[model samples]
Target: MSIQPGEKLVFGAPSTLSDRLTHYCPGCHHGIGTRLVAEVLEEFGCIKETIGVASVGCSVFTYNYIVADWVEAAHGRACATATGVKRARPDRMVFTYQGDGDLAAIGFNESVQAANRGEHITVIFVNNTIYGMTGGQMAPTSLIGQKTTTSPRGRNPKKEGAPLRMAELLAPLDGVAFSARCAMDSVAHVNAAKRAIRKAFDVQRQNLGFGFVELLSGCPTNLHMDPLSANRRVREEMIPYFPLGVFKDVTANEKAGA
Candidate 1:
């Protein structure tokens, strides 16, 4: 069929990058989280003025899909890099995309310290229980008794310790402007996740202090389950450990209205 110059393409245009399709497994939450962030950036019309700091783990390649200015940082160093970027470009919106293993495990110091300083930035943390990219190892957020490559039988709370509650951990910090936890197992949950992401960005736009949104995502490939089962697990297993809701919303305290 011949196409005219003014004719629109029949196929829907791609919302994300074509050169780099996501490597995440089916039903994995990384893709959903990425979509939410992209949508928020587009909605706020800050794609050009926004800077993203990509961290390690399954989401390390987040820079490839997000259509915005981005910087690659070392494992767990996304917050540090974001701090520098925000400090240099106060007018630009800065955010960090990190995983549980990267943020709560190896990057715990950076993550907590950044929130302590009340850095004007947004942090999107994806917690999938296991280390998706690193051979399904047990991460800091791994639930008690969850089996992983490193923990063959299961994670023992006595020896391995319990899962980390990231939002609650930072909720009491004076520097933290906003902190919330959401899931991506269902449409309702996904919508809620999007709202949380948008709120985080809105806070940053207002030059608010640190804002954090921890998304309880799925690692279907690492969890060794089909899409449906993985999502089910998120509802049945993950929610109890990491309840989904807004931990704090202090946007009104921000100097600029969010």
Candidate 2:
């Protein structure tokens, strides 16, 4: 439909995303995270030159939602796979969409190693605390005292350890050009998330070191909460532990090789 005179277009689906609806569970923030990536890709006008790696998890089918060249990596191996893709096609914008279990639990080594090596790729990590797929088990990033199938009585710091703060963990790496954490619970946070995502992609385009963005998301199904409650939990609970901000940014530095 043509826009009438005096009418302004405000919102529409990003062309980088597929026309098909996402398969994420109700209240899940994976859809929002994926869309934000697509929007940034569209804004960069690099969708045609982009290559996405989808790992095994709730976001395993990210290829179906994001309209771009894609490779499906094994559980917890997205970072390793993405490293190869970026090395093979230095001209293409490379990124990986991964979840807490895949990125922090199973693929922790790969995630850290890739960052330490400073591979020119962007990583979008969705931290929902619990594993949304494969029966709502506890993940490495599950909050303290948080209940999950594996931790029925709630996580015990003495035995289970605290949630892995990936952004903070990766920020200090010499190879990491950018590292940031953002929440998806409110309009303001979502806008901040978009900005973070844009910066993550920008680093790759500039051939900087590794770019990492951790998104604090919600898994309503696993959390046994409605959409609203899940969002509130992210705002009130997750955000406190995993603070949102650019933990490390090379652009912010002035001294050379400091």
What lDDT score belongs to each candidate, Candidate 1 first?
0.88, 0.93
Candidate with top lDDT is 2
Superposed Cα RMSD, model 1: 3.2
Candidate 2 achieves a global lDDT of 0.93
After best superposition, candidate 1 residue 216: deviation in angstroms?
0.8
Q: Per-residue lDDT for 163 in model 1? A: 92
List model 1 lDDT by residue over 77-185, tens digit each.
Answer: 9999999999999999899999999999999999999999999999999999988898899999999999999999999999988899999999889888889999999
Looking at candidate 1, what is the lDDT of residue 20? 70
- Would you give me the overall lDDT of model 1? 0.88
Residue-level lDDT for 180 in candidate 1:
95
Relative to the true structure, candidate 2 reaches a TM of 0.95
Pairs of colliding residues, candidate 1: none
